[model samples]
Target: MKAVLFKVGLVLCVLLSACSNSVDDSIDPETADDDLEGPISRPTSGYGVDGVYKVAELSFPNTEYPGTQVTIFYPQGTTSGRPTIFYAHPYGGEDKEYNRGLFEFIAKKGYVVVFVPYPTTDISIDHRYLTLWTGFTKAATDYPNIIDTKKVGFMGHSFGGGASIGLAYKAFTEKGWGQDGRLLFTMAPWYSYQISPAQLLNFPSNTKMVVQVYDEDKFNDHRLAIDIFKNIGIANAEKDFYYLKSSTVANYRYGTDHNLPNSRSAYDAYDYYGVYRILDALMDYSFNGNEAGKNIALGNGSTAQVTMPGYKNELMAPLEVTDNPSPKYTQSKYLFPCSSQENPRIANCN
Candidate 1:
């Protein structure tokens, strides 16, 4: 979880110079193969088809929120007006190396991504939200000409998933960022310190979201993802839920627990077919506006064939809304006694 902090003033200049730009600058998106029918196909297994864009990793200490650090993954020379994603790590997880493949995939797709790391000891969900906001604000300021701030996306896993919801809530209700377009993708979202279902209803109806759940998730359970999907008030057409089932037993270091999405080996069926493929499709649909990506995500026709063997998927076709369900809050074992008294700027801290 330890990151080497770099000087903020020199970050853009030094990091961009170090990065190698391999993307073809003249490829027009309107005529790109991504706009074709069926599922958007990948030319290779590991990397993306947008050619090579050098990956730049740099860390900067957040002055607004002390003890928080922002890590950026930028694809150098990806042309102007590229979409951006703000990523939040899971609780007690700090290393960007955990999801390096996924991050690289996103950057290679011509998007800027910023990962925010917060203190695990005196953690508060509001603090995590603020940390993400700081990261987004700083990234926008540093790469104004490169990033299209209007087309923003939020992604996270586990507790970070809950944090993504909180950040989106603020953007829609308070900050007005979602007025343009916003997309959210969360996996195995934990419910600790998340906003109420009513608060979620206030998000812009235009906001698109995808909730991913692991079938054998023991830590947070798949029901958490369902609950989040049910509470999201966006139009049924704008939201989708997926339940990912692993065909084979995971014998890796993290096993099948909640870490399946970030498993180190990309060759694994769950990581490659179940996790990465779905994520790539969602990003393509949301960021690139590819219809084929949407078809794949909705599990339409033979698109489910792209999933791993034995992977079961449920698409919210007739999207039913639940009536005023009682609030269910599952406290995290990592939760410690901390409040706004310690940090006045933390939202919703008691």
Candidate 2:
């Protein structure tokens, strides 16, 4: 047992050290300690303000798992049974300022937005999974009045985006979540572990999911996003894979990279139209049974879901979506897989 422990510890140290060298921690706006990065101009056309409830937010220090902090943003008037969103963050993305805009926006739209940052420095990615689950379970257990376990959504960006898949499986199977409604959204996600192929075949079939990949993200391979989009057990009708393209409106360009969801403070048209619009519709369709939301959120091939609003309500770049293995991101183009990522999880190399 001692010798086995030593090998695992040695491998984890090497993994963390190597990964720390590979990533630019500052690429995402984790620098902000407080407040949203200025004001975001909300689009008045799509995704109306269905939820104008004043939001109340609180942060909790985890005495049990000291490395993580869990914060909850919920409608101020809610007493219980509110739909919830469980958000996971990428590595080194512990600061709330990284996604404060999204959190506040979702909260104002009337959902319990839970943000939990997992440890990215010393622990194995598997332990990081535990940290995420610990924080999530802690929040749900402590605030049963706020989190409606039956109706919940799991979403994340980059590293968190990939992790959201494995975590959502845990949420659905163990907790019996999604009995009412569930949604999973991944934005330029990373390689996810802690979930076996068998588990991938068992995700809730009714779950609404969108695996979003950016056109300009040169870091994480798009194949990784394709992996989850293909493997997850959901049917074609229930899930969609989005290839978000970049757009230039006037002199300012909206680049769809790995960090579009993070926005680092200054949000653009994509944040409002490309993302938040569909997400709002997805939530409404899943949780509230709003049938109109299906066209915009999971709109099979509708013009509205595929097109994003650009300059002066003109045409922006449309999203490329496919449920099958896409030739655009083919096996020949498969660059970074488990073999090259050097993730200590060993599952990657498989």
Candidate 3:
């Protein structure tokens, strides 16, 4: 017993020494503070919904651009073949660091989020988006145990959002992928500004589509997304449309610019509400088989009702979500899921 104890003690001492040495080598002793905690940082706000967890980062290689990169926030502990979301960062955005807060929120909710970095200088050679799609495909193929290729959703903010629409159209129409699709929720995207009237009219409706617009957006026409939604709703195929009345209401903003990373503090509320709303729609549209897209209302004097594609006469109320019990922390108290129906517990990465 004495010999065993001594051996165990000796091994523990060696391990501790190794760890200490590693820390010494990696960190500058002069800069290191005795009070400094390690790599972990707590969230500034409370956890939102039940399935929502704090955000996390994921790194993968960019096949198109050898040294370039792509990142994702995956829900924790999700079993094999889970649904995935390809999230495109806003225009002129840097690494995943800028969107980490929002991505983390989505990731913790049992959905894998892929963030595409837009090359600021040259929009033509969007190798960043290519890399994102490629990396996502590779991850799904390589780790079928971790991803479900069948159920995939694409999303983006601003320019990223616009690009996501183009990408989705190409994927479904040109590439012949995701035939039996559900929905694409474009958060403050500019479909009307970027795509022409003909192009917008041409988009197919086999997949459900929802466009979120803030009334106060500065760039482009204010009601661009809603305008397109109306045209689509009136066009050939079946579609549903929803419009948010006030972007500045409870922890939400419509005036956010194309670059979210540079000014996260200025629009933290927008980040929270914008991301949560999109994710909520994607989750329901993809998994629940719910056709509640028509329930979104553009709050003004205009009288618009939520109606499914084929049966235009049948109107329904927008999705109703209830708030969860308050979180134990102070910062997170104001945070709430965009959809009251979202349960934060089940949404955790598990």
- Cα displacement (angstroms), candidate 3, residue 16, comes to 41
- Order the candidate numbers by TM-score, best to worst: 2, 1, 3
The count of residue-pair clashes in candidate 2 stands at 1
Ranking by lDDT: 2, 1, 3
Clashes of each: 0, 1, 19
TM-score of each: 0.69, 0.82, 0.57
Worst 10 residues of 1 by lDDT: 1-10
Which pairs of residues collide in candidate 2? 338-348
lDDT score, candidate 3: 0.45
Tens digits of lDDT, candidate 1, 220-276? 544456566766787666676765543332222212445656634332444545555
Which candidate number has the best TM-score? 2
Q: For residue 82, give model 2's deviation from the true position in Å.
A: 0.6
